[model samples]
Target: MALAWQGVRALARREWCSSWRQPAEWLTPLAFVIGVALMFPLGLGPEPARLRELAPGLLWIAALLASLLPLPRLFAADLADGSLEQWWLAPLPRPLAVALKLAVHWGWTGLPLVLLAPLLALAFGVDDAAPLALSLLLGTPVLTLLGGLGAALVLHARAGAGLLALLLLPLQVPVLVFGTAAAQGGNNAPVALLLLGAWLAVLLALAPWGIAATLSLMLD
Candidate 1:
C-alpha cells in the first residue's frame, strides 16, 4: 500500500515537474481559458443580462479547450526518450500510476479552472456564483477524465494530443451540455453533478486500461 502511494505521488510529481519546467504548457491553457471566456461578451453583445445567460456555456467550452492543449504530451514525452518502457515495468501498479498522472495533469489544468472560475464568472457577470463554481468543481472532472482517455487513446499518433482532442471533442458534448445546464442556474444542478461524477469515476476505472494497452502495443 505504501509503495503504491509513493509511486502515485512520484508519478504526479514527475508530471508536475515536467510541466512546470515548460511553463508554456501551464500558462497557455490558463491564458486560453481566460481569453476564450472574455470573448463571450463580444459574441453575445456584452449586455450583463446576455453575459449572465451565456457564461456557463462559454466557460465550459473554454475549459475543455484549455484541457486539450497539454494532452498530447502526456505519453509522448515519456515515449520519446524510452521512459514509457520503464513505466510499464515499474514496481507500482499501472492503473494507479496512470491515475496519479491524470490527477496531476488535471490539477494543473482542470482544477485551476475550478479555483479560477469565480473570476471567469465575475468577468461575465454570471449569477448564482456559488452554484456556478460548484458545478464546475464537480463537472469538470468529467472533462479531465475524458482528456485522460484521449491522452491514452492517442498515445502513439503523430500529433497525438491534437488528434486526441479532435476525437474526444465530440465525446465531450454530453458533459458540456449537462455541465452548462448545471452551471446556468436551473433545475438540474444535483442531477448534473451526480452524472458528471459518475462519468469521471467511470473514466478513472477504464482509462488506464486504454493507456496501458496503448503502451503494451507500442512494446510489441
Candidate 2:
C-alpha cells in the first residue's frame, strides 16, 4: 500500500513537471482569475463597500471558471500520445493514477487561486482574508475532482472543451453557492464550509473511479 501511494506521488510529480514545461496549460487559469477580478471592479464601479459585498461571489465565480481551463487538457494529451494506454496496462490501479493526476491538476490550477485569493480579495475590498482563502482551499479541489469526471467523459467527443463546460457548469452550481457563502463568513459560514467539505470528501472517494471507468470506456 505504501509503495502504491509512492508510485502515485511519483506519477503526480511527473505529470506536474510535464505541465510545467508547457507554461500555458497551468498559467492560463491563474491569469483568468486575475483578469476576472480586475473586470469586476471596472464593471461594478470602485465602491469599497460594494466590491466587498460582491467579492465572495465574484472570486468564487472566477475560480470556478478558471478550474475549467485545464479540464480538456487533463486527459486529451495523454490520450493523443498513448500515455493513457500505457497507464491502462500498468500494474498500478488506473483509478489511483487518475486520482493522483487530479490532485496535481488541482495543485497547478486551484492552489494558485487559493494563494492569490487574499490579494485579489483585498483589491476587491474584502477585509477578512481567512474565510476567502479557506473556502477556496476546500472548495477548489471539489471543482477539480468533479471536473476530472467530466473531462474523462468527453475525452473523445467532438469539441470536447465546449462539451466539458456544458456538462460541468450545472454540477458546479451547488459548489458556487456553498463556496461563496462560506467565503462571506456570516452566520452560516460554518455550515457552508461543512457542506463543501462533505462534498469534497464524497468526490474524493468516488470521482477517481468514475473518471477511470469513463476513460477506459472511451479508450475501448
**Best prediction by TM-score:** 2
As a whole number from 0 to 100, the lDDT of residue 210 in candidate 1 is 72
lDDT of model number 2? 0.89
True-structure RMSD, every candidate: 1.9, 1.4
Tens-place lDDT digits, model 1, residues 92-197: 8777667777777777777788888888888898645777777778777777777767776777677765688788889998988888887877678778877877
Instruction: Give model 1's TM-score versus the native structure.
Output: 0.91
Off by over 4 Å in 2: 1-6
TM-score of each: 0.91, 0.96
Clashes of 1: 1
Worst 10 residues of 1 by lDDT: 210-219
Error of 2 at 191 (Å): 0.3
lDDT of 2 by residue, 95-212 (tens): 8899888888888888888898779998897778999999999999999988999998888788989999999999999999999999999899999999999999999999989989
